[model samples]
Target: MAGPRHVRPGPMVEAWLIEAMERYNEESLERREAYAAQVHLPGAVLQDLVWWALQALPDEILVGLDVDGSQAHQPDVEAAFAGEAHRDGLFAGQGFVISEAAVVNRGDSYSVHHLPEDWTDDLFRSDRGNRGGRFTHWLHTHPNAPAVPSGADADAAQETLGVDMILGLRFSPEGPLPWFDDVDGTRRTLAAPEQPRRFGRRGPPVLGVAPSGHRIHEIQLIAFHRTGLGVNVVLVDDEGWPYGWSQD
Candidate 1:
């Protein structure tokens, strides 16, 4: 929706992603090792690019923000790092795109010299349930970087052919591959560093205590979404965390 806001993750969602990140890292390491062994390269020479999608708006059917009818044409990372890979002789490379679109309707059409792969379809054909209606984005891979959106990728976003996109790259197998986005389209890319992890503390449990000769206890869980700022807040006993909520 608007520009990026530094929001902390909620207890539930934070725990989810933290767990997901652990599994993700383990899987990535496994993939790297497998690829290295197959290619007879050092395990350190393969890298995985982690991608995250952003939604412009949160889904609010009750509020009547029915974000329906969207499409994602085929996106290609072929031209993304081809030249770099050829010259660099890197073992493996990765990239991904993030957007608010509902579906990756087709394959990559954005070629260096031709139109993007999925530009021909007119109706995006949303999925049947709420999953299809929620804030959605895409993730894609690339072997290297100029790392800006290509003329084609930029055009796809500017023309509203696609919602929004993020492209990522890893230089070497042993090096870190960062995610980047042209947030304001000012030639500056917003680099989303790895989100820091927080250790968890067991939440307080509900217990009955005498209050004026009556037993009372309450466990409050609150989740709030603010469209104006594209954020979601969760409160537990007055502490707050913000999520990168979207508006598109």
Candidate 2:
């Protein structure tokens, strides 16, 4: 019989995974019905945009959108940090871009120019430019799969995406919902207060909820790599994964 080999995971990795798993189980609960709350951002409506964007693009690719507004609104302070981990960067020629949940695009191409000028121009032009995107975050479908990020997802998220990532699960009985920030090496589950399952004319919307049970609507997850200049948005999926013409 061969002796047991030593397999060790770094302390940091172990800690992060523990944290993520704790979050996952803690937030896990019976699917319920709740109200949708809206969040206002500068470039464009991120939350609402994400819902439609995910539906349109069902495959795995980062996204970038041009959100040009006469004015930028005051960012939500608390909400900003909720899933910040999932917001990571990819090391392309340019600097880093935030990678949110996985992005799913059906058959349409969108441009991203609404991000902060410093972020888009400078970072996108940097060595890690491939990481940044004007798009919000990444999103993908599990195909009636689990709501958890897979080993491949975890790897891509850490190396490719460069930040925390969100996973969207497509359950048949329902449509699609999202889970965020398992990149710390741990699996953290995000959710709202448990409510009685309510079937509506439409399916569930991918968004965050407030303490008041209001869904943070019209919000989109954008990723920006840490640059001396500022954060830049990358043109990738909400999950911060790579994207190409041939990719999904």
Q: After aligning candidate 2 to the native by TM-score, how far in Å is the CA of 48 from where it should be? A: 3.7
Q: What would the C-alpha RMSD of candidate 1 be, to one decimal place?
A: 21.2
Model 1 stretches astray by more than 4 angstroms: 1-109, 112-140, 158-162, 174-248
Candidate whose TM-score is highest: 2
Worst 10 residues of 1 by lDDT: 38-47
Q: Identify the runs in model 2 with alpha carbons over 4 angstroms from their true place.
A: 1-46, 64-147, 158-164, 170-192, 196-248
**lDDT (Cα, tens digit) per residue for candidate 1, span 70-145:** 2111122122212311222221111111211222322232422122324223343333222132222222223223
What are the per-residue Cα lDDT tens digits for candidate 2 across 188-212?
2323334565677354443343223
lDDT of each: 0.22, 0.29
